[model samples]
Target: MKYKTICLIIFSLILLQGCVAIQSFPTVARAGDTVTLALGSSDQINIADTTVTYTPDGGVAVDLTSNVRSIFKLYPDRASPAWSFSAASGIPVTSGHSASVDIMVLDLPPGLVPGTGVIRVQNNAVYPIFSDIPSDADVAIEIVPGVGSPAAFAYSLFGNATAGNFTSLEAAPHFRIKPDFEPNAWYQAPTYAAAELTISGTLNAAALAATESQVTGQLRIIVDEMPTSLASQKQVSWARNGGDITINYLSPTGKMAYYETTVAVFFAASNYSFTATPNVSIRYFDIDGNVVTGPPVFIKSCTNATGCI
Candidate 1:
């Protein structure tokens, strides 16, 4: 699980005629998100390879040198972000297919997220080409929630595990509501101290006898870019910066669970700033039963711990 592929930031310099005719172009990225990888040329050969590596996720499996893209119109100097290697930097596939290069998805850090982790590739110039994806269409890549954005609650180490491809297993939520508003728009939670957010403890009993499904669900809050199931938000009074509340759960077998839901959120008369996206999903059964869901642990809380809460 170490496919850190965010390389190549050339400014302008192309000339590597050896073997790697650049191929395999289908890169769906996340983990810091910054994508653009189109390497063509299936067989209409016009050689000149660059370099690329990092393929870990079950290990060894490569094939990418399929070229067919190079027309040379020559005209790309967008404000000194240069990177052109002759042959018009290759881009025009159909003979054998290959032409795409815009990589930038750093380490993919930050826990793992909602589930879905893998970024394999193989085409380090000079005759390299590795990518087999196609088990029926290899599945495990979901990070889609953009409308203003704010639905990426990371930390999924593959979530409890059963095989992969995310199946859903909640219980990683803990929000005492009311922080910063104006995200999804529609705020009203001022009944003095609103309260009414009761979730009395009980994650003990050896994790409530190791679940199988009953891990509960909602307990939301997410303003910036919306999605706490649609912020419309409400957590009224007491906002001395919602005094100390941190969340992060998931312990069906996936480990790393945490909680701290004590929000009263003082400081009304609002301009909004909230953030506490919880969804709670932790169904289990790994003794052999095999149900697994775990992967909803997000607690980037905010009550002015510096401002951008």
Candidate 2:
């Protein structure tokens, strides 16, 4: 989804139980992009002692506490990394007033790739009893292909096969559709056909051997037809190549609505190989045929004689 403005999600830790609000700019970005997290601690807790963790889809989490950048006051009245205090630079001595620090600049990995990445911030301050220790704040951002790579859609997808049923998580990026009620909308007619989806991925050697280098499957696409409202479903056929496949179709369209789609592909194979997990990615094409890409998903192969778990 395109985040035009700051989207703040509040969370209270099960242990500390304090409100922590994190705001990330350019939630949709590419490699070499400088992303900032503007944290607001309403519970009057210092955010400097917070620990940040970055975890990408299907990847391990890495701590980024030391990556916090140092900043100075841009103006005398306000500081870049400012704090609200009552007396000294410590806690508040009066009622209804507390000490708090806001805004922390972070240095993200320079080699970020196209995928859905998560940033989690946990307050690590050791406070006195009854004092607030803000809870963890997590934000997931969609990373599109960088410059020189394919143009990306407004949304991305992540999928996996379970019991031969490949399904995407509901948290996946939503396929945005402008309301048909709007004049000059793409859903008017001809332009709708221009919106398309392409599923592409490469198969491992074991998968190739199991399917005799060819695999045909049925694809079920479920689209959130209206922004976050009703859903629509469609079915289609897709075939796999010796070690790869790329299937394209005219994506579903709606007027005055944003669309989110989840796909499932079924391929028949008596025995599958677990030697390697196959990776899959989905791309969307605009009315002008401009391509937009998202992060890929990895499917686990079932090598057991019984079948996939």
Could you tell me every candidate's TM-score relative to the true structure?
A: 0.17, 0.30
User: What lDDT is obtained when candidate 1 is compared to the true structure?
Assistant: 0.25
Question: Residue-pair clashes per candidate, as listed?
Answer: 60, 15
Worst 10 residues of 2 by lDDT: 71-80
How many clashes (backbone atoms < 3 Å, residues ≥3 apart in a chain or on different chains) does model 2 have? 15
Model 2 C-alpha lDDT per residue in residues 10-49, reported as the tens digit of each score: 2111111222334455577665454555443222223344
lDDT of 1 by residue, 44-109 (tens): 111133222333354542222221112111223422222234342222111111222222122232
Displacement of the residue 230 alpha carbon in candidate 2, Å = 49
* lDDT of all predictions: 0.25, 0.38
Candidate 1: misplaced stretches above 4 Å?
1-85, 89-110, 113-118, 121-309
Model 2 whole-model lDDT (C-alpha atoms): 0.38
The predictions' CA RMSDs to the true structure, in order, are 23.3, 21.8
> Could you tell me the lDDT of residue 64 within candidate 2?
67
lDDT over C-alpha atoms for residue 4 of model 1:
26
